[model samples]
Target: MQGTLNEIDIRSILQLIELGQRTGELFVEAHSGLTNTALAESNRSLLSSGGFGYPSPAPQPDERFWLVFAIDGRIVYAADRSNNNLLRLRDYLRFYQVESALDSTQVPLPSANPLEYACLWGLMENRILTPARARNIIKNTIEETLFDLFNLPQGTFNFEMGPALAPHLTSLEISPLTAKIVKQVQQWKQFYPLIQSPNQCPVVTDRDRLQQILPETTLANLESWADGKTSLRQFSRYFNRELLAVSGAIYPYIQQGWIQMSDGCDGMPTAASEADPFGIAPLLVPSEQEPHQRAPQVVCLDDDTTIGKTVEYMLVPKGYRASALCDPIEALSQLFREPPDLILCDLAMPNLDGYEICAMLRNSKTFRGTPIIILTGKEGFIDRVRARQVGATDYLTKPFGEEELLMLVEKYIGLPEIAPPPVLPSE
Candidate 1:
């Protein structure tokens, strides 16, 4: 069992494929006790927290999404994107048929930003269907496929994304040397805070990977990337020479695992010198785990410190949506337009205090008693009492822990709970 993770092979990869019924490729390499795996769009490493730079645009997938494993710095065995996409589509189809019975046929096929509705289709229209490829597409099934896909978690017998009953792992032996290396990863617990930062991106090196992830593209042009030779950043960008590409364009690619930033390769010097390849990171692959099941949305109303880092970190892992509004005025304006699930307000403001805003929301028929939480540097019972009188649902002092804030949200908003998976034994 110990040796199974040490240096994985294609057999394990194939099992993941067959079980997940995913498509695409899986890559892994091991020397000594270190192991690494790479998940292609088809691979199931989507489960890993910070595994790849890209996720298949197709929403359907093979594994549980969490519990993805890694060998060293690479993916070894993982789910396939194609199969995952197919499963997602199947779910959508089942849902659409169950509720609507094909009567409301708007033709809800998988759609990518640039690819055709039939891009996945292989035939002359009759039976030719392109399989699922990206994670987003599978998730955003024309609003019609949700009937079947959303009901799968019920009735038990859930499918998992690990080994196929450990088919002769060759040697179950684990060495002390390997365990030592695996233990090194434990020190990174501090980085746990960064895991939920959705904006954090991996490096993108492939153009096709970018093309697959982006909203729209004209693949009809750009020849260098056509051969799969150019880096994803190069191929994916349209006149990508713009400076904003890194922040705007490429960042999303990194988020999706189509590419990855250079992580320290094994044995590479951590201390930088003028000689290294400005990057020494591992190639991004699938995350090797499942995505969070549910996340609550958060509306942060603050102007000066408007950045919602805490909210972003708390909700991103669970795939929650968060919106930031620096001005309480703006937050108030947005509520009538579109109400967020939860609201976080500040006690004092330049023009209006958090209490005043809460009162205004309470007056509204739609927002009355909305889960409003207050954050203030000042700590006093009178202030707390005032906030509660104005309809604040929860309150906290400044400088809060992520868990504390998240708990408040879970209690008030009823967003889904998603527990992260346990870290696997390393090395």
Candidate 2:
């Protein structure tokens, strides 16, 4: 029955509700329109069709769904499932029917919502977005919200939400946050399958165009890529295949400079050279060799500590510069006043713990651009999570291997460079 319902019935029901003026409230059907009251009255038939409740009407995949919102007999807004707002309303409707039972004047949107909408608000507060951004952010937030709420299969989730939003979709996007009486109706209309396939997600490509270039493959990676890591191998381990298969699948991308294989890489699985996948760096592989360099600078915040000497001993000739400081507070101050390319600090310090220092540095206008590492005895997934939360670029547990530490450092500071190409390359 859910699959059978179409646009005409949805509009017809909205007309009926306005005509009747009966206002207990209605919630997100999840996927239903109010079946006739007779359908509700009949217990056996409804039960067999999967419920007394409404069906979750997923749109025909990666397409816009229109939700018309009217108040006091006039259309006020619209939202759609593409933005995942339909799913959001589905979650909220599980407790309170947005359609059948809303008391618009009395209720307030949660001050702290457990949905993507809340994070969207946060994104706005940070000035990370602009006026031209509302439509896309709302769509992305809704998609994000729906993905979480329904545990919706990832393929149907998309981030290719473009610059313009239809009026109906925009209405649903903002409905739950407003104080107006919302008389809305939803319609599943097909788009030309916008950025992804009819049932696919976008690949976070530097350009939205690539999703069009490789729809099926993009759909395959949505959930696995959501953690937003740079490594493609990490995304495909879920497929239970050898690394080469995944690499071969995306090899065209590498040739096009979409990813890169790392040095010491034996043609093993590597990202496209351009790394357009990560949306960082272009599709180009640097020379696969260690670079000529002065030394990697490693500054330890705890003065009179053995860390500096140990690092220095491990330093390959022309590979590292190790220095120590007794006072973390002073070191932090000095770091900004006269900075190096990288900083490593102990988490447990006398004047300020690693977290506090990191916050200060991150908040400081001068050090805002610098990357800081934390050396902590506390190390676990949770600890690493917290380290990232506090803005540490990377976390190193106590008793770490020398190689582990350097690799972590290298990943950020980047390899050393040769001198600039002699201006204009004298012929």
Query: Global lDDT of each model?
Result: 0.40, 0.40
Give the root-mean-square deviation of each candidate in angstroms.
24.5, 21.6
- Once fitted onto the true fold, the runs of candidate 1 whose alpha carbons sit more than 4 angstroms away are 1-295, 417-427
TM-score of 2: 0.30
The sequence of per-residue lDDT tens digits that candidate 2 reaches over residues 1-427 is 1221333333333444344432211222233333544323332232223212222333344323332333322232233323533233322222111222222222124422223333333443453432223333343333322322222221111111111211221323122322111211011111221311112222333334445565554433432343233233332222322223344454454455443333221212222321223222212112223221333456767554677555555443324555667787678767866676677877778768888888888786556545688888775677678778888888777777778877876665543332222222111
Candidate 1 lDDT tens digits, 1-427: 2223224332343344444444232322111222222223223434332222233333333332212122222222222222222232332233122212223223323332112122223221232221211222232331111111221231111123343311111111112213332342233233333221112333335667656634333322222222233232221121212112223333444465554544322211122122211112212111223232234467888664534655665666654566667777666778779877688887878788898988988888577536789988788899999888888877988878878877887666544433432332121
Pick out the ten consecutive residues of candidate 2 with the lowest summed lDDT: 179-188
